[model samples]
Target: MNAPRLIVGLGNPTDQHASDRHNAGFWFIDALLRHYPGQMRPDTKFFGDVGEVRIGTQVVRLIKPMTYMNRSGQAVGALARFYRIDPEDILVAYDELDLMPGSARLKLGGSSTHNGLRDLTAHLGTPRYWRLRLGIGHPRTLNPGQSVINFVLGRPSAADQQLIEQAIDRSVDHLPVLFRDGWEIATQQLHSADPAMQAKKEAKSSNPKEEAGEKARRRAPEDA
Candidate 1:
């Protein structure tokens, strides 16, 4: 039988870093655990909490490396070697500032200047692994360095937290699809318009009478 595919989530393991924007990977893993409570118990061999789920004949292993975010490759490389898993079968989920909040993109290769990814590539000797980039969104001007750092380390605002939480929940629901249908189709389904957008579209397509009624409702009595 073939070994299970591995899904590694990169993040620091500390209360200070728990809710940070950079810890979206951790948040995603937590979301997955909540969704599959029986699967992701702590395992010392993986250097963190590890869980397993079967997808037909394939077994998928979920890993949350406890070596901290910066040196995540240490734990990840060790686990991969121990399990005899190839880099191609590994999927990494991490935060990316390039994308907007509530958005996620999955791709291969190393396009951005991410130290964690660079380190992983160096350790694995290739950039062939799958990456799920969860966007934390870029910062506004005025002290950009501090802003970026703060974003990575600091807790999000209430609204941002809600967005991130919702995204995390959505990610949990879509993860199986990711493993089954591949990234492209899964991404389309994940990032597609929300119910609000669908409602607006439906409203726009209403009969002419409804449109006239809406317009009349917007007008003053005299104007109507």
Candidate 2:
């Protein structure tokens, strides 16, 4: 059998950080657990709780590093080494300030000013891991002295929290599809606007009178 894949959710482990914007990664994992219970349990060696679940014939391990966001690499590194899993097989989920709320993007790439990813690359010595980035829009204005930290660590307003939670739910639903199908197919299914697509199809099936009127308008100009 193939070695299990690791899905690590990056976040700080503290009551204070539980609902913070920076902890969106953990929020996703929490939502996943709610959807599929009894798949994970606490494992102290990883410096966090670890859970295992089977999707088809493949077993995927879910991890939440206990170390604070900046030091997440340590816990992840330890888990990867113990499991003998390659970096490419590891999937990480985290929040991205550049993306708008209630939106998410999945890609495999290098760290981009993301402290968690930076430290992770430093420990793993590679930047080839998969990532699911949850969007948490940037603050309207900048503040001095650890402003970035404050912005990420702060709790979101009620409306923003609702949006983030909705995104999390969608992300969790997409995970099973991701494992069952490939990324491209799963992404389209998850991100595509179904209602908008239906509307477009309906518009194409306009009344016969409207189509006839449009044809008459075109022919009138030619006749003149």
Per-candidate total of colliding backbone pairs: 0, 1
Give the 10-residue window scoring lowest on summed lDDT in candidate 1.
192-201
- Per-candidate TM-scores read 0.76, 0.79
190 Cα displacement, candidate 2 (Å): 3.2
Query: What is the lDDT of every predicted structure here?
Result: 0.74, 0.79
Q: What is the alpha-carbon lDDT of model 2 when measured against the actual structure?
A: 0.79
Predicted structure with the largest TM-score when compared to the true one: 2
Displacement of residue 32 (Cα, Å) in model 2 is 0.8
Spell out the clash pairs found in candidate 1.
Answer: none
- Model 1: residues with Cα > 4 Å off, grouped in runs: 1-4, 39-45, 55-57, 141-145, 193-224
Query: Which regions of candidate 2 are displaced past 4 Å?
Result: 1-4, 141-146, 193-224
1-224, model 1: which lDDT tens digit per residue? 12228888888887877878888898887777677644666677667778776654566788888777767777788788898889878888888877656666667676557767877887787898888777677776322566677767777777777876776787778777766776677767776633334566588667777877777888867785
